[model samples]
Target chain A: MEGRERKTLVLGVIGADVHAVGNRILDYAFTQAGFKVVNIGVMASQEEFIQAAIETSAAAILVSSLYGHGEMDCRGMREKCQEAGIGDILLYVGGNLVVGKQDFGPVEKLFRKMGFDRVYPPGTMPEEPIADLRRDLGLA
Target chain B: MELSVKQMDPEEFGRQRQEVLTAWPTGKEVDFDEAVAYQKELPAAKVMAAKLAQGKAKGVTYAQPRAGVALISEHIELLRYLQDEGGADLLPTTIDSYTRQNRYKEAQGGIEESRSIGRSMLNGFPAVNHGVMACRRVVESVGVPVQVRHGTPDARLLAEVTLAGGFTDFEGGSISYNIPYAKDVPVENTIKYWQYVDRLVGLYEENGVRINREPFGPLTGTLVPPSISHAVGVIEAVLAVAQGVKSLSLGYGQCGNLIQDVAALHTLPLLAQEYLKKLGYPEVMITTVFHQWMGGFPQDEAKAYGVISWGAVAAALGKATKVIVKTPHEALGIPTKEANAAGLRTTKQVLNMLRDQTLPQTEELTLEEKMILRETRLILDKVLELGEGDMAVGSVRAFQAGVIDVPFAPSRFNVGKILPARDTTGAVRILDFGCLPFDREIRDFHQERIARRGRDEGRDPSFQMVIDDIYAIGKGMLVGRPRG
Candidate 1:
C-alpha cells in the first residue's frame, strides 16, 4: 500500500474546530486503507484545504466538522476549489453538520448543492468513505 | 478602552440595545414592553431563578442536558422529549455556531436550508435568526424553564433576543467563553460585551423578572486545577453581581476525583457568597451547577456510562443545585435525541437515589476544601490587586501577566503557562504554577503531590505526564502509565 502508486486524498477538520480525536482517527484509518493521506490536522481554513489539495495533487478533500458548524464552515469550499483551478476535485464532508436533528437526506443534498461530490452523516464508519472514494476515483 | 467591572447606566444600555437589536433582522422583533409582559405571564415552573431557588431550598438537584437543532419545531419537540421522556427538570436551547459568532446571515441561510429539506442544518437553535416570536414558541412548547446555553463571547444581542423570547437563564462569561473557545478575541472586549448582557438581566430584575446567569465553569475542561476554575467562577459571579444581576450560579466541571470534586462544589458557593457579600451584594441569591466531565470520554458506551454515573454521583453528594448531564455517546460526536434522553434518565436516577444520602464529612474532605479555598483566595486576591480593586480590569491584567491561567485553553490572550496533572488520587494539581501568585505553602503542596505521583509511577513529573493524563481516562485508566 505504501509504494504502489496509491491515490492521494487530503483530509482535515475545517474551520475553528479543534476536535482532533476524530481527525487523527480518520487519518489512521485512511492511511491503513491504502490512500496516500495528506492530513492537515484541525482548525484548517478553506484556502489551506485547496492549497493542500493542489500541492498533494490529491483526488479528494474530505472535511470533518464535529463542533456542529460544518454548514457555515464549509459554505464556499467547493467554490474556493473551483476558483483555484480544481473544479473537478472530489469534495466530501461528514459529521454533525447542523445543530438540530434533521433528516440526513436534505443535509446530504445541501452539501451536494454546495458542490461537494459526496456527503456523509454523523457516525458514519470509515469503511464507507474509503469504499466510496475507491469507486468515485475509479480505482476499484 | 479599559473596561472596569461596573454596571452600565440604564440610558446607555438602552442605546446599546437599539444597536444590538438592529444587528440582524430578528432584532426588530424584540419589544421590551411586550417581552416583559410575556415573561410576567410565564408559569413559575418556567422561571429559572424560581426553580433554582426551589431546588436549593429543598436540597434537591435538578438535571439538565445539552441539546438543540436548527429547526425551531424540531428543537421544541426535542426539548419536550427531554422534559417528558428524560424527566429533565430544566431545558437548554444550545445555540448554533453561526449565532455564537454573530454570523446571523449564515444562520438565516441554515434555517432556510433546514426548512426546505425538512431537517435541521445547524448545530443549534438559531434563536437570533429565529427572531423573538420563534424563540417564544420554544419557551411555550417546553414545560420547564429553558436556558440559552451557548459559547458566545459577545452575547449581548443573544441575551436581548432570548430573554425577550422568554429564556430564563443564560450561560457563559467573558473569561469562560473566551479563553476556551476563541483564539484571538481580547478579554477586554468580551468583558465589556457581557456587561451589557448583565445590565440587561438587571433591567429584568428591576421589572421583577428573574433570570439566572451562569459563568461557564470548565475552562478548557481538561486537567484544570480546581483553584483556577474556582477563581474564574468567583470572579465571574462578582462581575455579574456588580451588573445588577440578582440570581447567580457558579459552576465546576467534574474532575473525576470524589474528594476534590466534592470540595470544589462545597467551596465554590461559600467563596462566591463571601465575595458577593463583601462587594455589597449580600442579597444576591447564589446557587451551584456541576457539569459532567468535559474532557475526552471513553469511546465504549459502557465505559462512557461509568463516567456519566460518576459525574452524577459527584453532583448528588456535592449537593449541586443542578447537574449538567452528559450522554454515553459523547465520544461518538453529537448524540442522537435518544442518547441525550438516556443521559438525562441516568442522571435523574442517580439524583433520586442519593436524595436521602450525603457524603460523610471526613478529615480529608476538610483538608481538600481548605486547600481549594486557600488557593482560590490567592488567585482572586491577585486579580483584584492587579485591577486595583476592579475585577474586570484585574481579570484582563491577570491573564496578561499569567496570574490566572487555564490549562489547554485556545485563546492567544491566555498565557498558556500553567500545566496540570492528576495527583496520586486522581485529583488535579498544578504541575507547573507558571506565574500564579500562589504563596509558598500552596506551591509546595502541589509540588509534593506531583512528586508523590512521580515517585509511585517511577518517572519525573514532566510534559509526558500531562500528555498521558489527557488520554488516560479514554483508555480506561485515571493515570496514564508507561506501557509494560
Candidate 2:
C-alpha cells in the first residue's frame, strides 16, 4: 500500500434521486482500488458534494441519479461547484439521466456541455469510472 | 421501539385506520364492514387469492400487466380492454408516482389536469387521492381480481384505502418497496409502516375476507441474484404471515436463464414456506408469480416480443402461478394501453402454446434450485441471527449490517456491498459478495463460475461484465460480449 493518504473521492445520488446500488458499488470499487470515498448518500444537493469535496480535499465528485428526473435536478451543478470553489473537481454523472429513451450520445453531449468531466449511459459498471478516476487523478 | 414480529391488536389497528382514513376524504368512505361484506359477495373469479388458487390448481401461469392512468374512467376503460382483449387472468391498478411519494395534493392536481386535457396525465391511478369509492368503481368494473401495484415505502394508507375500497389483493412489502425505490427512507420506519399494512390485511382475514399479499420480488431488478430477492420475499412473507395474512404470491424476476429463472420460480414459494414453517407460521398458502424480464428492453417491437416470449416460456415451464408481463414499449417509457394489451396477449399466446408442458427436471436445474435454496437460507439465517431470532427486527438490522443487501437498491439503509454479474451461462453470480452470509463453498461456486467466464472471454471477470449484461438484452444479446 502507498504510504501517502488515499486520494479522496466525494460521491452521491444527486437531487431527489435515491438510486443506491450502483452508487454503493462505485464506493466499494473505488475504495477497494485504494481511494478514500466520501459517500454523501441520496437526495444530495450540488453544494453537498462540493462541500464534502472541500472538506475531504476530494479529487472527484461522482454524481448518480436513477429517478429519471436528473436533468432537472442536475441543472447548474457546475455553476454551483464553481461558486462553492471546487470548480475543477472531476465531476462524473450517470444513470437513467433523462426522462425518456433518448440517444445516449446527445445525453452525454448535453451533460458535457453542462461542464461534467464525463457522462455515462445507464447500466455503466464501476470499471470505467474507476479507471477514469485512476488516470484523471494521476495515480497511474 | 423495534417492532417485534407480532399481530397488532384489533382496536389499535382500528385507531391507526382512523388516522390513515382521515389523511384524505376518500379514505373516510372506507367502511370496513361494508368493504368486507362487499368482498364477501364477490364471485370467486373477482378475488385474486381465489384466482391464484385456481391457477395453482390448474397448473397454469396467468399473465398480468402493469397499467394505470390519472382519471378513474380512463383507468377502468384501460382495465376492460386488457381483460377483454389481452386475455389477462390477473389485473393491477398501478398507483401513481405522486401517490407513491404520499403527495396526494400533486396527485389531485394531476387528476384535475387529466380531466381538463381529455387525456391521462399522471403515470398511474392515485388510489389514495381517488379514495375508496373510486377504487371500488375500478374494482367493480373489472372482471378479474385486481391487485394494487406500487413502489411505496410506507403504504399504510394506500393499503387501508384500497383494501376497504374492494381490491382483493395487494403488492409490496417493507424491504421490497423501500430498498429498491427509495433513497433516504429509513428501513425501520418502512418495516413498521408495512406492519400496519400486513396487520390491516390480517384484520380483513379475521373479518372473513381473503386478500392475497404479494411482496414485490424484483428488487433493483437489474441483475439481482435469485437468492437476494428470495431472501427478501421470504422475510416479507414471514412477516405477513405472522400478522395473520394467509394467502401469498411470492414473486421472482426472470433472470433470462431458463434453468435459473425456472429454478427461481420453483424455489421462491418453497423458500417462503420453508422460512414460514420454521418461524411458526406453517399453514400459510403460498404461490409463485414470475415476472417477465425486468431489465432493459429492445427499442424494436419485434425484438421485445422475442424477449416477452422467452419470459413466457420461462414462466410456463417454471410453472409460476402468474407472470407479470412487460410491454414492447418498455425502453420508450410508460406504454400506451394498446401496447400494454399487446404485451399481455403476446405472453398469453406463448403460454397457451406451452400448456401442460413443464421444463423437465435436470441435474443442472436441480443444482441451481439447490444453490438458490441454500444461498437464500444463508442470508435469511443471518438475518434472524442478527435480529436475535425476530424477522422484523432482523430485516432492519440485516440491511444495516449489509447481511441482506439488495443489489443496486438506492436506500441508504441498504448497505450496497454485493455486485452481481452474469456468469458464463448468463445466470447471475456475485462478483463482489459484499456482506452476504454465504458459506465458503457457496462463495467458491460463485467464484469458479465467474472465473470460468473470465477464462472463456480472455478477460478478467470484472464489473465490465455487469455493464455488458445490463445492455445485452437491448442489443439483442443475453451475455454482454466484448466488441471485437
Candidate 3:
C-alpha cells in the first residue's frame, strides 16, 4: 500500500464548452498533487469522460463546465457511467454549475442527488478537489 | 523530420507563387513588379511603416479599429465612418472568415449574397475574392494608411492580393495566427505558408516597397502571460526579417494590470530590437501595438467605456505606436458603425488627454519590466536552443515540446499544457509552468506570487482562480477573489 501505483483521474470540460484554460489547470493541479490525470480537453461529452475513465481504470471523473450549460450537459452522467459499467467511479463536478448566481445550496444538493460525489461552486479552487480526491481514493 | 521555417529562395518562391496565385480568379493580377511600382507611388503618408515611424518619433499612440464588410462600397463606407467619426489614426480591412479559411468560392458566394442583399453577409472584407482592383478601391477610398488584418492559417494568396492591391501593413504570423485562430492547423504548415507571405513582402522590399509586418502579439488574448507572447512575437519578427522585412510592429493584448500592461509594451520593442541585433538584423525598425481588453466585456455600455479608456491610458503612457480599439458592443456581438465609432472616440479622448504625461517609472513598474525582460529572454534562448539556433525550426519544435504553449490555444499542435491565472494584482501568472524552460528562481517567483494571493483569499492556488479571472471583467472586478 505504501508504494502503490498512482491512481488515475479523468478530467475535461463537458458539453460544447470550449473552455480549455480551466481544464488545463485541473490537469496540472491533479498531476502535481500525484495522480495519473487523463485530460480529454474542452468540448467533451459525458460519454467521452466515462469512456476514458473505464479505459484508464480511473478512480474519479472530474467534470468542468464554464459555459453555464452544466445543468443540462451533465444530467444523466451518472447513468451513463453506470451503463458504461463504471458506475462506482467517483464523480466530481464544478464551474458555474448553473446559469446566473442561483443559490448554491440547492444546486449542490441537486447535483449530489444526481450522483456526484462532490459539487464545487464556480469559484471552488482546484486544491479542494485534490484534497477530496486524495481522501476519496484512499490516498490520505 | 520535415524541417520548415527557413527563408525560401526567390526562384523557389516564384515556382510556388504560380500555384498560390492560381488558387482564385483574382490571383491573376498579383504581379510583383507591377505591385511594387504601385506601392512606390502611394503617398508616403499612406505607407504604414512611414506613418508608424512618425508615431514612434512623436510618442503618439494611434488608434486603429477592426472593420470590413463583404461589399466593396459598404466596406469603404465603414472605414470612412471609422476614420471620419471615430478619430482612428490608422485603418484596417479585416478579412472575412471564409477568406481566412481559404474558402474563396464560399467567400465569392458570400460576396454575391452581400451584394444582392445590399448588406454584408460575410463577417469581413473578402479581399482575395475582390481581387487587386476591388482592394484598391477600398484603399483609394480611405485617407489614412491601410493595414490588412486577418486570422488565416494559409495567407500566401491573401498577402499577394492585398499587397498587390496597395495594403501598406500586414498583421499576423505563423505562431501568432495559427495557435490562437485555428484549432488543428499545424504550426509547421503555417510557418511555411507565412514564410511565403513574408518572402512576398521581402520581394516588395527588394523593389523598395517598405511594407510593415506585425506579428499578432496577443495570442489567445485571454490572460496570456507577456513572456509567452513576447517570445512568440520576437520569434515571428526574426522569421519575417530573415525574409527581408525591415519594419515590424509587435503587439500585446491588455492584461488588466496597469504595471504589467505597461511593462509588456516597454519590453516588447526592447526585446525585439535586442533579438534582431543579436540575430544580425540590427536595423529592423520595431514598434509596439497595445490591444484593448480582449476578454469578456461588461454588457453595460458605461462599464465598457471604462474598460476601453483604461486600455487607452496604458497604451498612451506605455508609448505604444498604436492602440487597437474595441467597441462597447463586445458582449452583445458585432458592433454597429456608431458603436464602433463611439468606442474609437472614447479611446482617442483618453489618448489625447494623456499624451503629454508619462506614468513616471514607479518602482513596481521598473521591477515588472526587469522581470518581463528576464523571463522573455529565457524563453527566447530556449526556443533558439531548441531549433539549434534556427528560430524557424526552433519555434516549431518548441511548440511540439510544449516549451512555448499559449494558455488556451486550440491548435492541437500546441501542447496545451501551460496554465495561466492572475496573481493578486491581476497580472497573469502561470499556474502550471510545465515544459516552459524557466529557471527555478523564475518559477518560484510566479509560484510565490500566486501562493500569496491564495493565502489572502483563504484558499489554495487552483483552476478556480482561472475561472474567476475569466469572468472578472464582466462581473466588475479583475482579481476574481471568491465571494463571501
Compute fnat per model. 0.26, 0.30, 0.07
Backbone collisions counted per model = 9, 2, 1
Q: Can you write out model 1's per-residue Cα lDDT over B316-342, one digit (the tens) per residue?
A: 999999999999888666778898999
B456 Cα displacement, candidate 3 (Å): 1.4
Task: Name the regions of candidate 3 deviating beyond 4 angstroms.
Answer: A1-140, B1-6
Better model by TM-score: candidate 1 vs candidate 3: 1
Q: Which digits, one per residue and each the tens of the lDDT, describe model 2 over residues B1-484?
A: 3488877776777777788878877777778789889889989989999988888998988899999888889899999999998988989999876688787886787788779868665668889988888888998998999999998888988998898888999999989989987877898888878889998898789889999999999988889999999999998998899888999999899899999998888888888877887877859878998889888788789999999999999999998889999998786666777888999999999999998799999999999999999999999999999989999888888988889877777676878878888888899999999988889999999999988988889999777688778779989998888888
**Model 2 / residue A27 / CA error / Å:** 9.5
Ranking by DockQ: 2, 1, 3
DockQ for candidate 1: 0.22
Judging by TM-score against the true structure, name the best candidate: 1
Alpha-carbon local distance difference test for all models: 0.87, 0.85, 0.86
Scored by lDDT, the top model is 1
Residue-wise C-alpha lDDT for candidate 3, range A30-130, written one tens digit per residue: 88788889998776779889889988998899999764457667889999988889899899999766533356799899899999999987656678999
Cα lDDT of model 3 overall? 0.86
Q: Which stretches of candidate 2 lie over 4 Å from their true place?
A: A1-140
Say which docking band candidate 3 falls in.
incorrect
